[model samples]
Target: MRDWLIQLRKERKLTQQQIAEGAHIDRAYYAQIESGTRNPSMAVASQIASFLNINTFLFFPEHLSEPFTTALRNSPIIVAHCDLELRYTWMFNPHPDFNTDVIIGKRDDELDHNEGTIGLMKIKRKVIETKKPIRQYVSFPLSDGLITYDVFAQPIYNDGNQLIGVATVSTELLT
Candidate 1:
Protein backbone atom coordinates (compact mmCIF):
# COMPACT_ATOMS: atom_id res chain seq x y z
CA MET A 1 0.00 0.00 0.00
CA ARG A 2 2.81 2.41 0.81
CA ASP A 3 4.56 1.47 -2.39
CA TRP A 4 1.40 2.02 -4.39
CA LEU A 5 0.94 5.47 -2.89
CA ILE A 6 4.55 6.36 -3.57
CA GLN A 7 4.34 5.24 -7.15
CA LEU A 8 1.07 7.03 -7.72
CA ARG A 9 2.42 10.25 -6.26
CA LYS A 10 5.47 9.96 -8.44
CA GLU A 11 3.32 9.44 -11.52
CA ARG A 12 1.49 12.62 -10.66
CA LYS A 13 4.78 14.50 -10.17
CA LEU A 14 3.88 15.14 -6.54
CA THR A 15 5.86 14.88 -3.35
CA GLN A 16 4.76 13.74 0.06
CA GLN A 17 4.91 17.32 1.25
CA GLN A 18 2.71 18.42 -1.62
CA ILE A 19 0.08 15.89 -0.82
CA ALA A 20 0.20 16.72 2.87
CA GLU A 21 -0.26 20.37 2.10
CA GLY A 22 -3.08 19.61 -0.28
CA ALA A 23 -4.80 17.58 2.38
CA HIS A 24 -4.09 20.23 5.03
CA ILE A 25 -2.37 17.77 7.32
CA ASP A 26 1.10 17.77 8.79
CA ARG A 27 3.68 16.49 6.34
CA ALA A 28 5.38 14.24 8.86
CA TYR A 29 2.06 12.74 9.89
CA TYR A 30 1.07 12.19 6.31
CA ALA A 31 4.44 10.56 5.65
CA GLN A 32 3.82 8.16 8.51
CA ILE A 33 0.40 7.28 7.08
CA GLU A 34 1.87 6.71 3.62
CA SER A 35 4.52 4.49 5.16
CA GLY A 36 1.84 2.52 7.02
CA THR A 37 3.34 3.33 10.39
CA ARG A 38 0.22 5.36 11.29
CA ASN A 39 -3.35 5.20 10.18
CA PRO A 40 -5.26 8.37 9.37
CA SER A 41 -8.68 9.29 10.68
CA MET A 42 -11.46 8.82 8.14
CA ALA A 43 -11.58 12.53 7.41
CA VAL A 44 -7.86 12.60 6.85
CA ALA A 45 -7.92 9.48 4.71
CA SER A 46 -10.74 10.91 2.66
CA GLN A 47 -8.85 14.15 2.16
CA ILE A 48 -5.80 12.28 1.04
CA ALA A 49 -7.83 10.04 -1.25
CA SER A 50 -9.53 13.03 -2.78
CA PHE A 51 -6.17 14.67 -3.36
CA LEU A 52 -5.00 11.50 -5.06
CA ASN A 53 -8.23 11.21 -7.05
CA ILE A 54 -9.03 7.74 -5.77
CA ASN A 55 -11.92 6.15 -3.92
CA THR A 56 -11.59 5.88 -0.14
CA PHE A 57 -12.26 2.14 -0.27
CA LEU A 58 -9.09 1.71 -2.34
CA PHE A 59 -7.15 1.98 0.92
CA PHE A 60 -8.89 -1.11 2.30
CA PRO A 61 -9.38 -3.09 -0.91
CA GLU A 62 -12.12 -5.69 -1.41
CA HIS A 63 -12.90 -8.28 -4.04
CA LEU A 64 -16.28 -8.90 -5.58
CA SER A 65 -18.34 -12.11 -5.30
CA GLU A 66 -16.04 -13.50 -2.62
CA PRO A 67 -17.24 -14.33 0.84
CA PHE A 68 -16.88 -11.34 3.15
CA THR A 69 -14.57 -13.28 5.44
CA THR A 70 -12.32 -14.39 2.60
CA ALA A 71 -12.11 -10.95 1.08
CA LEU A 72 -11.27 -9.42 4.46
CA ARG A 73 -8.69 -12.02 5.44
CA ASN A 74 -6.46 -10.80 2.63
CA SER A 75 -7.28 -7.17 3.10
CA PRO A 76 -4.83 -4.58 4.33
CA ILE A 77 -7.41 -3.29 6.81
CA ILE A 78 -9.15 -4.98 9.71
CA VAL A 79 -12.63 -6.10 8.66
CA ALA A 80 -15.72 -7.68 10.19
CA HIS A 81 -19.24 -8.66 9.19
CA CYS A 82 -22.38 -9.00 11.27
CA ASP A 83 -25.70 -10.68 10.71
CA LEU A 84 -28.99 -8.77 10.55
CA GLU A 85 -29.36 -9.33 14.26
CA LEU A 86 -26.01 -7.59 14.83
CA ARG A 87 -24.24 -10.77 15.83
CA TYR A 88 -20.73 -11.07 14.55
CA THR A 89 -20.57 -13.50 11.64
CA TRP A 90 -16.96 -13.10 10.44
CA MET A 91 -13.87 -11.18 11.32
CA PHE A 92 -10.44 -10.66 9.78
CA ASN A 93 -7.38 -9.41 11.58
CA PRO A 94 -9.42 -9.12 14.73
CA HIS A 95 -7.92 -8.18 18.09
CA PRO A 96 -5.25 -10.58 19.24
CA ASP A 97 -7.17 -11.67 22.32
CA PHE A 98 -10.29 -12.63 20.38
CA ASN A 99 -11.11 -16.29 19.91
CA THR A 100 -13.11 -17.01 16.80
CA ASP A 101 -14.88 -20.03 18.26
CA VAL A 102 -16.18 -17.96 21.14
CA ILE A 103 -16.99 -14.78 19.27
CA ILE A 104 -18.44 -16.04 16.00
CA GLY A 105 -22.06 -16.03 17.10
CA LYS A 106 -21.87 -13.30 19.71
CA ARG A 107 -22.50 -9.59 19.99
CA ASP A 108 -19.76 -7.18 21.05
CA ASP A 109 -21.13 -6.74 24.54
CA GLU A 110 -21.41 -10.47 25.09
CA LEU A 111 -17.72 -11.06 24.45
CA ASP A 112 -15.83 -7.79 24.64
CA HIS A 113 -17.21 -6.50 27.95
CA ASN A 114 -16.02 -2.96 27.36
CA GLU A 115 -17.80 0.38 27.18
CA GLY A 116 -16.32 0.98 23.77
CA THR A 117 -17.93 -2.21 22.56
CA ILE A 118 -21.29 -0.73 23.49
CA GLY A 119 -20.58 2.35 21.39
CA LEU A 120 -19.52 0.20 18.46
CA MET A 121 -22.70 -1.83 18.76
CA LYS A 122 -24.72 1.34 18.63
CA ILE A 123 -22.90 2.39 15.49
CA LYS A 124 -23.60 -0.98 13.88
CA ARG A 125 -27.24 -0.77 14.82
CA LYS A 126 -27.52 2.68 13.27
CA VAL A 127 -26.02 1.42 10.02
CA ILE A 128 -28.38 -1.53 9.96
CA GLU A 129 -31.41 0.62 10.65
CA THR A 130 -30.60 3.43 8.27
CA LYS A 131 -28.97 1.41 5.50
CA LYS A 132 -26.38 4.15 5.23
CA PRO A 133 -22.61 4.30 5.40
CA ILE A 134 -20.66 5.88 8.24
CA ARG A 135 -17.04 6.65 8.91
CA GLN A 136 -15.75 7.42 12.37
CA TYR A 137 -12.56 7.61 14.37
CA VAL A 138 -12.89 5.28 17.32
CA SER A 139 -10.69 3.88 20.06
CA PHE A 140 -11.07 0.83 22.25
CA PRO A 141 -9.12 -0.71 25.07
CA LEU A 142 -7.43 -4.07 24.65
CA SER A 143 -5.71 -6.34 27.13
CA ASP A 144 -2.33 -4.83 26.32
CA GLY A 145 -3.19 -1.32 25.25
CA LEU A 146 -5.63 1.04 23.60
CA ILE A 147 -6.12 0.92 19.83
CA THR A 148 -7.69 3.47 17.53
CA TYR A 149 -9.27 2.82 14.18
CA ASP A 150 -10.54 4.78 11.24
CA VAL A 151 -13.81 2.91 11.26
CA PHE A 152 -15.96 2.52 8.15
CA ALA A 153 -19.29 0.75 8.41
CA GLN A 154 -22.04 0.19 5.88
CA PRO A 155 -25.14 -1.84 5.28
CA ILE A 156 -24.69 -4.85 3.01
CA TYR A 157 -27.29 -5.75 0.44
CA ASN A 158 -28.13 -8.66 -1.84
CA ASP A 159 -28.72 -8.55 -5.57
CA GLY A 160 -32.27 -7.44 -4.97
CA ASN A 161 -30.99 -4.56 -2.83
CA GLN A 162 -32.47 -6.19 0.23
CA LEU A 163 -30.56 -5.51 3.41
CA ILE A 164 -28.50 -8.49 4.43
CA GLY A 165 -26.35 -7.23 7.27
CA VAL A 166 -23.54 -4.81 8.08
CA ALA A 167 -19.85 -4.82 7.29
CA THR A 168 -16.98 -2.76 8.64
CA VAL A 169 -13.42 -2.06 7.60
CA SER A 170 -11.13 -0.23 9.96
CA THR A 171 -7.49 0.71 9.73
CA GLU A 172 -5.62 0.88 13.00
CA LEU A 173 -4.04 4.14 14.05
CA LEU A 174 -0.69 4.53 15.78
CA THR A 175 -1.86 7.01 18.37
Candidate 2:
Protein backbone atom coordinates (compact mmCIF):
# COMPACT_ATOMS: atom_id res chain seq x y z
CA MET A 1 0.00 0.00 0.00
CA ARG A 2 2.68 2.43 0.99
CA ASP A 3 4.49 1.41 -2.15
CA TRP A 4 1.45 2.13 -4.27
CA LEU A 5 1.03 5.58 -2.80
CA ILE A 6 4.64 6.24 -3.62
CA GLN A 7 4.10 5.03 -7.19
CA LEU A 8 1.01 7.17 -7.67
CA ARG A 9 2.73 10.32 -6.46
CA LYS A 10 5.81 9.70 -8.57
CA GLU A 11 3.75 9.16 -11.74
CA ARG A 12 2.66 12.77 -11.34
CA LYS A 13 6.23 13.82 -10.63
CA LEU A 14 5.04 15.37 -7.41
CA THR A 15 7.41 15.38 -4.47
CA GLN A 16 6.30 14.38 -1.01
CA GLN A 17 6.65 17.98 0.09
CA GLN A 18 4.52 19.09 -2.81
CA ILE A 19 1.78 16.58 -1.97
CA ALA A 20 1.95 17.58 1.67
CA GLU A 21 1.46 21.21 0.79
CA GLY A 22 -1.34 20.39 -1.62
CA ALA A 23 -3.13 18.31 1.02
CA HIS A 24 -2.44 20.82 3.78
CA ILE A 25 -0.35 18.24 5.57
CA ASP A 26 3.16 18.29 6.92
CA ARG A 27 5.77 16.73 4.69
CA ALA A 28 7.09 14.58 7.49
CA TYR A 29 3.65 13.24 8.25
CA TYR A 30 3.09 12.42 4.62
CA ALA A 31 6.41 10.61 4.58
CA GLN A 32 5.16 8.39 7.36
CA ILE A 33 2.22 7.45 5.18
CA GLU A 34 4.53 6.47 2.39
CA SER A 35 6.68 4.43 4.76
CA GLY A 36 3.83 2.15 5.80
CA THR A 37 3.57 3.09 9.46
CA ARG A 38 0.46 5.20 9.95
CA ASN A 39 -3.24 5.13 9.16
CA PRO A 40 -4.64 8.35 7.78
CA SER A 41 -8.05 9.79 8.42
CA MET A 42 -10.63 9.44 5.68
CA ALA A 43 -10.60 13.20 5.38
CA VAL A 44 -6.93 13.08 4.64
CA ALA A 45 -7.50 10.49 1.93
CA SER A 46 -10.20 12.65 0.38
CA GLN A 47 -7.98 15.70 0.51
CA ILE A 48 -5.27 13.75 -1.28
CA ALA A 49 -7.67 12.37 -3.87
CA SER A 50 -9.09 15.79 -4.61
CA PHE A 51 -5.63 17.25 -4.94
CA LEU A 52 -4.65 14.47 -7.31
CA ASN A 53 -7.90 14.52 -9.30
CA ILE A 54 -8.74 10.88 -8.54
CA ASN A 55 -11.79 9.23 -7.04
CA THR A 56 -11.20 8.31 -3.40
CA PHE A 57 -12.74 4.89 -4.02
CA LEU A 58 -9.86 4.02 -6.31
CA PHE A 59 -7.57 4.33 -3.32
CA PHE A 60 -9.65 1.83 -1.37
CA PRO A 61 -11.24 -0.37 -3.96
CA GLU A 62 -13.52 -2.78 -2.15
CA HIS A 63 -14.48 -4.39 -5.41
CA LEU A 64 -11.31 -3.98 -7.36
CA SER A 65 -11.95 -5.38 -10.83
CA GLU A 66 -10.29 -2.85 -13.10
CA PRO A 67 -6.79 -1.49 -12.92
CA PHE A 68 -6.76 1.96 -11.37
CA THR A 69 -3.36 2.93 -12.67
CA THR A 70 -4.59 5.86 -14.76
CA ALA A 71 -6.45 7.30 -11.81
CA LEU A 72 -3.44 6.89 -9.52
CA ARG A 73 -1.25 9.44 -11.22
CA ASN A 74 -2.12 12.02 -8.61
CA SER A 75 -2.79 9.78 -5.64
CA PRO A 76 -1.32 10.93 -2.34
CA ILE A 77 -0.84 7.47 -0.85
CA ILE A 78 1.59 4.84 -2.04
CA VAL A 79 0.03 1.85 -3.85
CA ALA A 80 1.31 -1.53 -5.04
CA HIS A 81 0.10 -4.54 -7.04
CA CYS A 82 1.28 -8.16 -7.19
CA ASP A 83 0.45 -10.89 -9.69
CA LEU A 84 -0.95 -14.37 -8.97
CA GLU A 85 2.52 -15.83 -8.99
CA LEU A 86 3.11 -13.67 -5.92
CA ARG A 87 5.48 -11.53 -7.87
CA TYR A 88 5.15 -7.82 -7.36
CA THR A 89 4.39 -5.92 -10.51
CA TRP A 90 3.69 -2.34 -9.40
CA MET A 91 4.20 0.23 -6.64
CA PHE A 92 3.23 3.92 -6.60
CA ASN A 93 4.49 6.58 -4.24
CA PRO A 94 6.54 9.77 -3.78
CA HIS A 95 9.92 8.30 -2.91
CA PRO A 96 12.43 9.56 -5.44
CA ASP A 97 14.41 6.34 -5.79
CA PHE A 98 11.29 4.35 -6.75
CA ASN A 99 11.19 5.77 -10.23
CA THR A 100 10.99 3.62 -13.39
CA ASP A 101 14.73 3.05 -13.04
CA VAL A 102 13.95 0.90 -9.98
CA ILE A 103 10.53 -0.68 -10.50
CA ILE A 104 8.10 -1.18 -13.46
CA GLY A 105 8.94 -4.67 -14.77
CA LYS A 106 10.88 -5.85 -11.74
CA ARG A 107 9.88 -8.55 -9.29
CA ASP A 108 8.75 -6.66 -6.20
CA ASP A 109 9.03 -9.67 -3.86
CA GLU A 110 12.76 -10.11 -4.28
CA LEU A 111 13.39 -6.38 -4.41
CA ASP A 112 15.42 -4.98 -1.53
CA HIS A 113 13.08 -2.02 -1.28
CA ASN A 114 10.29 -4.28 -0.01
CA GLU A 115 11.58 -3.61 3.53
CA GLY A 116 10.72 -7.06 4.92
CA THR A 117 6.94 -6.94 4.99
CA ILE A 118 6.08 -10.57 5.83
CA GLY A 119 2.46 -10.04 6.85
CA LEU A 120 1.56 -8.50 3.54
CA MET A 121 2.88 -11.48 1.62
CA LYS A 122 0.93 -13.95 3.72
CA ILE A 123 -2.30 -12.04 3.32
CA LYS A 124 -1.78 -11.82 -0.40
CA ARG A 125 -1.21 -15.54 -0.67
CA LYS A 126 -4.41 -16.17 1.22
CA VAL A 127 -6.33 -13.85 -1.06
CA ILE A 128 -5.02 -15.62 -4.13
CA GLU A 129 -5.91 -19.03 -2.74
CA THR A 130 -9.36 -17.97 -1.66
CA LYS A 131 -10.13 -15.96 -4.75
CA LYS A 132 -11.70 -13.24 -2.65
CA PRO A 133 -10.97 -9.63 -1.97
CA ILE A 134 -9.24 -8.91 1.33
CA ARG A 135 -8.35 -5.84 3.31
CA GLN A 136 -5.66 -5.57 5.92
CA TYR A 137 -2.98 -3.37 7.45
CA VAL A 138 0.69 -3.69 6.64
CA SER A 139 3.61 -1.46 7.60
CA PHE A 140 7.21 -0.95 6.52
CA PRO A 141 10.03 1.26 7.79
CA LEU A 142 11.61 3.92 5.63
CA SER A 143 15.32 4.44 6.21
CA ASP A 144 14.88 8.07 5.21
CA GLY A 145 13.59 8.85 8.72
CA LEU A 146 9.82 8.56 8.74
CA ILE A 147 7.34 6.53 10.76
CA THR A 148 5.63 3.53 9.17
CA TYR A 149 2.13 3.58 7.63
CA ASP A 150 -0.95 1.41 7.85
CA VAL A 151 -1.43 -0.03 4.37
CA PHE A 152 -4.78 -1.00 2.94
CA ALA A 153 -5.12 -4.03 0.64
CA GLN A 154 -7.63 -5.43 -1.86
CA PRO A 155 -7.78 -7.81 -4.81
CA ILE A 156 -7.60 -6.99 -8.52
CA TYR A 157 -8.90 -9.20 -11.30
CA ASN A 158 -8.45 -9.62 -15.02
CA ASP A 159 -11.04 -9.08 -17.74
CA GLY A 160 -12.61 -12.48 -17.09
CA ASN A 161 -12.78 -11.71 -13.39
CA GLN A 162 -10.01 -14.13 -12.63
CA LEU A 163 -8.14 -13.11 -9.50
CA ILE A 164 -4.90 -11.78 -10.85
CA GLY A 165 -3.18 -9.84 -8.11
CA VAL A 166 -3.54 -7.69 -5.06
CA ALA A 167 -3.55 -3.90 -4.77
CA THR A 168 -2.78 -1.81 -1.76
CA VAL A 169 -2.93 1.80 -0.56
CA SER A 170 -1.16 3.19 2.47
CA THR A 171 -1.82 6.29 4.56
CA GLU A 172 -0.01 7.88 7.49
CA LEU A 173 -1.62 8.81 10.76
CA LEU A 174 -0.74 12.31 11.78
CA THR A 175 1.13 12.19 15.04
Off by over 4 Å in 2: 1-76, 113-116
Best candidate (score: TM-score): 1
Mind sharing the TM-score for model 2? 0.48
Output the worst ten-in-a-row residue range by lDDT, candidate 2.
54-63
Candidate 1: 10-residue stretch with minimal lDDT: 56-65
How many backbone clashes can be found in candidate 1?
A: 0
Candidate 1 — which pairs collide?
A: none
TM-score of each: 0.56, 0.48
Q: After superposition, how far is residue 162 of candidate 1 from its true place, in Å?
A: 1.2
Cα lDDT of model 1 by residue, 1-175, tens digit:
4666765677568999999999999999988988889878778988887576553444554433367657556454777787777776556667777754455546888777776787788889999888899888777898878887788999987569988678998887776
